[model samples]
Target: MLRLDRVSAGYGRAQVLRDLSLEVKAGEILCLLGRNGAGKSTTMRAIMGLLPLMSGTIWLGERSLSALPAHEVPRAGVGYVPQGRRLFADLTVAQNLEIGLMARQSGPEVREQVLTLFPRLRDRLGQKAQTLSGGEQQMLAMARALCLRPEVLLLDEPTEGLQPSMIAAIREVITALRAEGVAVLLVEQRVDAVLEVADRVAFLENGQGGAVMSAEALRADRGLVDRYVGV
Candidate 1:
């Protein structure tokens, strides 16, 4: 449902992604694995139109996402939870989610569905985002993105800094999203987490995609993880 073809993007003269090509199909979870500075986050930024592409194109089905402004990208059936969560620290959980709904012009039903996925957020609706624990903040971020009711979801390190239990909860939600037919493009440093939820894995090396493999294949031959991700 989401396609990136020979995408090359960077900040100013320092190019980070070079001729990168990949696709995330509907109902599929594709995890991107790479060490730091491998352009994983850059790929997410390129897809979100936060960084102007130096070359290539990004497409969501037939619509060219590269042509849309950053603000309009989310409205075009794309939901993004960038690394660091980037939540409105001062806003209450409910208010933060409301911003996401407003962006898509979504209704209360969408809010209900998101809250259902993140039940913990329901109890903390009035709590400031900055006051929540690390795991709770992460849940709120994902819940806010789901409020967009997007067909494609871009998640960058959604499980970072969370405890094992919270990690499992986040993974469960990701798997559920796949069952619901949301295309997921995830950038994760945790190999175990990737193996648990990803249908396929793409390795990024020095701003280029090196290999694409099924999650099972990687599980069978974990050496690939060391080769690509240096773990």
Candidate 2:
């Protein structure tokens, strides 16, 4: 489980998140939906310790994520996939995954698990990341994060710009992760994807989180989406 309590963070003196609070429970997906500048990505950065918090705390169960250095946050069982698939472009798929394994000191067994999850990556192990297609690159990024065997996973726009088939593949993987008891915090613009995969949805407005409602509820009342995320 992961919890962000009244978290406020931003770049320099300009704050992006203002007292934002939300939680992701184990074995469930919590999708974050909002307009472009509602601080969705900022929430992920704060949780990853990529941005320093001005106030409040982020907790991974009993562990204080805000207290950890950016580098140490992943070691504490948090895996992140930023908006851009920030992979080592020149490295081979296997090599990129190796870096993730090294981060958690994971072994061959972990690599095997990741490869199994992303069978496409198995064949592309020796291929350079930069040479892969967008969908493949996204798969590599998610696979690398899974190598950490993370308890909490932060994924920002994982399905962005992918074909429908690829998006379905990514969604399937996320759903599988939830079944395996990983706490997922997903920042997604695709309402259909969120409705299919998320257990609950949290909307942000001006960097603050409103009430979290069940995915089923949102599906029943479509107006909520227009109100928070707009058309």
The most accurate candidate by lDDT is: 1
lDDT of each: 0.95, 0.94
1-231 per-residue lDDT for model 2 (tens digits): 899999999999999999988889999999999999999999999999999999999999999999999999999999999999899999999999999999989999999998888999999999999999999999999999999999999999999999999998999899999999999999999899889999999999989988689999999999999999995
Model 2 TM-score is: 0.99
Error of 1 at 222 (Å): 1.1
The 10-residue segment with the lowest total lDDT in model 2: 203-212
TM-score of each: 0.99, 0.99
Question: Cα deviation of 6 in candidate 1 (Å)?
Answer: 0.6
